[model samples]
Target: MTILHVSAVKSWGGGENHIETLCYELKQSNPEIKNIVLCVENTLFHERLNETEIEFQTAPLAYNLDLRFSFKIIALCKNKKVDLIHIHDPSAIALTIIADKFASLPPFIFSKKTSFPIKNKKLTLYKYNYYKIKKYLCVSEETRRVTVESIKVKDKVITVYQGTSITNKSSETDFLLRKKFDIDESKKIVGLIGNHIRAKNLETFIETVNIIVNIKKRTDIIFVQIGSFTDRTEDLIAKVHELKLENFIHFIGYIPKASNFIPQFDALLMTSQSEGIPEVIFESFYHKKPVISTNVGGIPEILQDGINGLLTKKQDSAMLSEKIIHLFNNKELAEKFVTISYEKLITNFTASVMAQKTLKEYKNILNGN
Candidate 1:
């Protein structure tokens, strides 16, 4: 059976990365499973997909809600004899809702990656149709709950914690990656990996950096900001310059393969307004790295403060800074957190577990079970 994966944007950002990773793992599980990705035309992600063997298609419209693209999706689904359609975003889901009427209905799945406030009537209608649609594959428990409570979707939601394939020991010898970023050999490195956008709480993160620098007075302390931004890169750069955090912070624009460097960080950081369960958190823990994340989304489900990892209030720069500084000051506590996080990842977030659960749901949905 063919599976048609669709998204509104063509960028290989967080959501796109999740889709690619799932498709890769699904293909590995069943080599005969035909998989194809569909996105808007003329985007960088389309070019990036060319690097992989995964087949690709494009819609002739911007990511906006357009009825015309429904016909295009219908024709492609019919031509490919697609048995499953996994729409990755609300916009694409909106298009799919209309397309399903005109096209051969497939087992449609929607993965809600973001917790955006819905105001558009058309989108709300699509959200309401969750029961009528096929399974709702949520990336986090909180996401599934939100669909039930906020979006008013019924019991059709299924939680699939985001999975990462990286698993290896970090060589304490390879400290040169820190040196390359101008970080001191002796100082511990803390990292924040996500878009450099304002909504990601970059300003608060930078403020936290300033506090850490001031309290520690150790120039060896380095903070790494990985991933690129949209709509606010220039402003973020300007703010970094204004804050004069040049020596303390390193902003390495969107890393296509960030796992290669994730091992070097002593700890990982996340400060965002919203999220499903972030894939990076699982990856960091899988790599045996501790985290200092803001309390948001499904983070509470995964992180128990003073246990696995430290969690602070969202946008609270002082608490975030204090936790990082504490992790730096107390090596014993940091090591404990890292130890438990690793155990948790190994037990609950294995890629095989995620895949098997997903396949079971797919089969059940198909069998009308």
Candidate 2:
């Protein structure tokens, strides 16, 4: 089966990581399957494939309606004899619609990795319904439900949790992650990983740190955020400065395979206002680390309040601080959370398992099932 994976996202996040991992696993599982990845030029995703032998190509996609890029997509579909087109972003879906007019492209498959509702518009409906979308592989049950509510394609949607590699990831050296940041090992470290964006709700995380440090007088705890700067970056950084949290909070920019460094953290923190099934959550599980995240989107589906992890309401910095402190002080509870999450990760959310499930769906779709 020949599949063309299309993604136009410029930034690298869980969605990008999902695409890369899915493609790599697909190639490894079935070397006969001609899997090709089409990513935007100069993106973090593009740079990530440089050392790998994955069959990848690049296109300079500027907008959702770039006809030139659309033409290239059509050419790849025809020349590569692509039996399926698995897109990783909304922009790539738009390209599929534009290509539908001028070429007899293959059936499209889209992975909905976020709970954000599809916009209700004539054009939006046309883009989704007009194309031959075989299946909507949602990363979570919540995503599937939201997709059904937002679009008229209920039968086409299926919940396929984006499984992660549970195998331990080895870093290059004895990573002195805290030493480089000048953070002492004796202090408790909480880490957040994601792009500095509105959805990530990094401001709330910073505010929670501010409260933990200044209000609670817990100078022994240091909060570190690792991610790329988005449009809302200046405001987030400015908030840190205004709160006098420069020393307490460290904004460590984007680092690939961040979980390798996360073993140093006391607990993983995610203040996202939105998510599907966060890959980092699974990473923390593999590392035997607990997570404190906002109860948004599909987080609750994975993070049981007192079971695998702790969850608080969105934008609730005070409550978030409380959860953070709870994890820090309660050793038994923290260890229990880690143990339970790791068990689930091994049993269900593994890369090999995801590949088998996804490949089965692909085969079924190809067989007219």
Instruction: Write down the lDDT of every candidate, Cα atoms only.
Output: 0.76, 0.84
In candidate 1, residue 268 scores what lDDT? 92
Q: What is the lDDT, from 0 to 100, of the residue 171 in candidate 2? A: 44
Error of 2 at 249 (Å): 0.7
Task: Give the alpha carbon lDDT tens digit for every residue of 113-138 in model 2.
Answer: 99999889888877766548888899
lDDT at residue 144 of model 1 (Cα atoms): 76
Task: Quote the lDDT for 222 in model 1.
Answer: 82
Candidate 2 accuracy as lDDT: 0.84
lDDT digits (tens) for residues 129-225 of candidate 1: 7554667777777777777654554667778877765433333443355667766668777878887655577878877887777665656678888
Q: Give candidate 1 misplaced runs (Cα > 4 Å).
A: 66-69, 117-123, 127-132, 150-153, 166-176, 215-218
How does candidate 1 fare on TM-score? 0.90
